[model samples]
Target: MRTHDWFSRKKDCDDKGDPEAVFNVLDSMLKDSLERLKNMRESIPLENVGFDSCTLEAVNSRHATLFGCLCSEGKWKTALWLRRKLIQKGAVLDVFAHNLLLNGLCKIRDMERPDCLIREMLEMGPPPNLVTYNTFIKAHCLKNNVDKALYLFSTMATDGIRPNRVTCNTLVHALCKKGLVDDAKKLLCETLSDDKEKTNSDLITSTILMDCYFRSGDTVQALGFWDQMLHKNIQIDLVAYNVLIHGLCLGQHINVAYGNFAEILKRGFIPDCFTFNTLISALCKEGKVEEACHIHDVMLKMGVAPDKISYKMIIQGLCFRGDLVKAIEFLNCLLEKSLMPEPLIWNLIIDGYGRCGDLGNALSVNNHMLSLGVAPNVFTFNALILAQIKGGNNVRAYSLKKEMLLNGLFPDLVTYNMLISAACISGHIAFALDLYDEMLRKGIEPDIITYTELIRGYCMRGNVKEAEKLSTKMRRSGSQIDHVPCKILIKKYCHLGEHDMAFHLYQNWLMREK
Candidate 1:
């Protein structure tokens, strides 16, 4: 019914003997439907739209594109509904169409529909292709249902559908993600030995295993696999080069990673931001800031504009190396380049300044962030509060806490903990207790750290009985209370000449441990 205009427009143009007008109107209608296919498919009649072969082909092509978009957006139910509409309209939902639906079901983890669709595909005559089985297999693998995935793999041979590179890649990547790199390696060898032509899949599998091995801190095997990949002449791509470099860097084999970077450039492949970031991160992590900076300069000279991630990594590297001044300088440089530092970058720089005992500079950074209209979150507030506390200005910290509340920012665990600890340290037991009550009223679950700080405050006030009550609550809070606080309490009791009470508490603790 919605397509009535399309037909009427075509007929009117045809009657006027304007063939060009007819074609233009039909083309425009098809384009409009393509843009809103998700909406059009439900309302438009596919069976008797009075379209020729060319327009009909356009409809089918648009349907295919629409199916892909739906799957990508995870609208599995709508995609299924569209399939039913097509079938009811007597549109021949081809093998590719069915496969797209199957992929959608797999993506949404709709187990029952996928099985039904597979069964229907088997009965309806267009046999399931390798892509169909691969989708199902990859889905099961991702869900950690590896047994089902393997079963599907085994059944592929019986169904006479040969598994391809994508199939192998899916299974291998899943195994690696589950930290079963050894199992992945075994599968890789078995598959490659059975089918020698799966070289591309082998490259992907090898890269996955290399990254996994590095993550598990097994540098020997990671490098060995890298060597094996090269010896086999697998025609490594830029992606493969990047993976090996990252793995080698993660394993602290920066020299080898650098060598691989040189090899990548020599092979006429342009290194991406990932390549430079990986190398820079590795160098910075090793406290080789000079080398990292040199690489940063080289990256700029190579015409690859450093992104936010690149700057963040360098800033973090500088922070870790105790170069807060340089970190702030870099932040200023980023601002000068019209690159507004992200909240995370600002947080890191603020924290770096705090660590270097420059509370003034930290607060200065916070103020700069505010002036730029970058609304500070709890992390920003917490950092500033922490700097104030560290600078022995608890009053300023409290004022910031008030300012944070005025701005409607809910204080998280760290915020409360910092405030509580600072209050206890300054012997403001009453204020600490009030903050604790406020934290509870806000539904923020207090951890052992909170309890320990409160207990210490009570003990400092010579209120051992109140401290004991807090200790009992700490034990029941499902948080691990460290023995340091218990030791402190024991020392307090001994100082009070209450040795019997101290011994009783120690015996109770021993009994609980047993």
Candidate 2:
């Protein structure tokens, strides 16, 4: 290549990603150009016109082209310097200079100067056009003032300017976000009723309509609207399918959701973490564990790296099915790679171990959780207590409760209710009553579960007298902790031939629902 061509190519790359070469070229070229333009002015136009006129005229077409290239590369300062030289000529700036200035102002938030700059643009010979209005609307949209963007649309028509497809699409998007779907429909009807192929056929506008339909639970219309968009040949992006897939999942149609995900792949779009997470969750909800695992293998096969959420979804599914063994193995896999699971993921594993009467595994997982610097909260300790009680180990369960209090985490109603129920189920009526008193002394108000557990404990002990007393107390307390306790009372009383008390209890329980 010629030496000048080599220098030019290197100089251009400098502005792109090679700043060093860009700087070197501009430094040498700027000094040489300025000096040459000055000498040339001394030769010709300096005698007949203002010195600044010679300077602006010295800015040749080649110089403007170079300025434009720099602007495209985001070297705004260089472009601004060239504009200033032209303005200094006592020559009003031209349309190209004004448009570039508007674009630069919009790219950066020069909020205070927009109106002033627009006025100056008008003061120059060329008046503003549709491009100017669209740029201004885009500026408002960037600041998230959707209302002002709509106001610009009305102003455009009144100012005798014809709005284009982009202008209408921008208005539709802004209105839909504000939930003014009716007004959006009204505007679209007026504009696109006669020209459905031109206006209703716009992809951006149709995408927002699909979003509204999906959100409103009109899934039928939401899916059908795709045909219009497809007819217009407006390529649906990832965001479009994301919204659709989410809607399908909400309606529990996981199969359809998977179909949409496949379409996204067929269209050459890469599925993001959100897409994968949604798909995994749907598969898990359907208990398709084997298919969910297959997705993990496919993700690796296709080079789609699984994010942390992907691991969390699969782990949560295994935990839900009481397969804590596999869940723990997967969790360890993530940890070996140094990715700590979230607290919710840990809680799922804890719940699984607790339910299986495995206090040892539960406590082990809780200890590993603390080692990861995630503190166990009220729900965390509650799970362990429930597990131990289920395992017939109340002594250790109470110890865990003490540890919980010392950790500054107070037991909530769920902890109290579960503890008392464990006592009842274990036939420890006296222990259940003692805990109920302690709960009252602590000023923790008893709810339906607390009262029902107490009543059930008395009935279990065959102490019909005390059970009747507690039933009266529950009646005055007003409302069912559970109506099932009333049924238990009915069954017990009728078995003993005390039909009168059973009738009274059933009548009171039924009245509360009214």
lDDT tens readout by residue for model 1, 17-127 = 656766797799889888898666655555465668787677677788889899889888899888887776667666787788788888777678998888888897358
How well is each residue in 1-514 modelled by candidate 2, as lDDT tens digits? Answer: 3534555576444323555765787799899999999866655532356546566556544454665677678776667666666555534444555666667667766655556667666675456678877888878777778877777778777657777766766777667767777787788777654444464346567778888877777788777777776776676778878878887887788888888889988999988867777778778888987678788877778777777888988998898787888899889988987888888888889889999989889889988999989988888988888888878898888788788889998878788898899888889888888888988888888887887888888887888889878877877887556667778889889988999888987887789667
The TM-score, computed over Cα atoms with residue i paired to residue i, of candidate 2 is 0.66
Against the true structure, what is each candidate's TM-score? 0.74, 0.66
How displaced is residue 468 in candidate 1, in Å?
7.6
Task: Provide the overall lDDT of each model, using Cα atoms, as 2-decimal numbers.
Answer: 0.84, 0.77
Top-lDDT structure, candidate number: 1
Deviating ranges (above 4 Å) for candidate 2: 1-180, 187-201, 426-434, 437-445, 475-482, 494-500, 503-514
- Which residue ranges in model 1 land beyond 4 Å of their true spot? 1-82, 104-115, 189-197, 333-340, 355-360, 371-373, 391-393, 406-408, 440-514
Error of 2 at 122 (Å): 15
Clashing pairs in 2: 14-18, 448-481
